[model samples]
Target: MTDTGREEVVREEVARAEEELRAAAALLTAGIPRVAVTRAYFAVFHMARAVLYAAGYEPRTHEGVLHLLSLHFVKPGKLAVAHGRVLARLHKYRGEADYGDSFVIDEPAAAEDLVAARDLCERLRALLPDESNRRE
Candidate 1:
């Protein structure tokens, strides 16, 4: 695909990430904390994909996404390493919430995940090409 096509995909992913974050918030409000954590992790994961797409890389797996983000953005000083840490933490919590039989996701934990996901998406959004530029 052309760079233009890639940018469009990135934009779409970013939009999806935003929508996922909103869904996470809704789930949290509805008192489904565990599911909220999973949704929040996906929001950040989509944001990571957008970043990778803008960088001309499309990772095929969750680990690939995280690895690319660390190599391209965090290590290169484009994004702070703390963002990577937040992503890692979210990923970890999401796995526990989803797969662990006894995992407990309380209100505060879900709220923190939501906030972290939102911040990560915003940071990645700034890194993507402007919509006007990508449209052309």
Candidate 2:
């Protein structure tokens, strides 16, 4: 992809990230904790993809995104390791919320995931040059 194409894709990913966050909050407000947890994890996942795109990476899976986030951002000190932990935790919770037959994420756990999602999104926004700083 050309530079413009890559930039456009990254922009789309950032928008999707924000949209997922909004959806997560709405699900939480509607008392759908399990779905909210999934959305929260997606929000952070999309943000991680956006960052990876900016760094010229094309992650093909959830685990790939998490691994790349740690390799390129956390390990290199581009982003704090705590943010990577948040991604990993959210990923785990999301799996439980999505695939575990008897698992249900409580409202408190979903809320915590939402916060982590928002924080990770904010960190990515600050790191990406094309992302708006309107929320800052």
Q: What clash count goes with each model?
A: 0, 0
Clashing residue pairs, backbone N/CA/C < 3 A, model 1: none
What is candidate 2's lDDT per residue for 1-136, written digit by digit as tens?
7778877878888888889999999999999999998898998898888888887899999999999989989999999989889999989988887788887778987788898889889998788764433332
User: Model 1: per-residue lDDT, tens digit, 1-136?
Assistant: 7988887788788777878898999999999999998899999998889878887898999889989999999999988999999899889888888789988879897898799889988888788767612422
User: 61 in model 1: Cα distance from truth in Å?
Assistant: 0.3
What's the TM-score of every candidate structure?
0.91, 0.93
Best by TM-score: 2
- RMSD of each candidate? 2.4, 1.9
Model 1: runs farther than 4 Å from truth?
Answer: 132-136
lDDT values of the candidates?
A: 0.86, 0.86
What is the overall TM-score of model 1 with all chains considered together?
A: 0.91
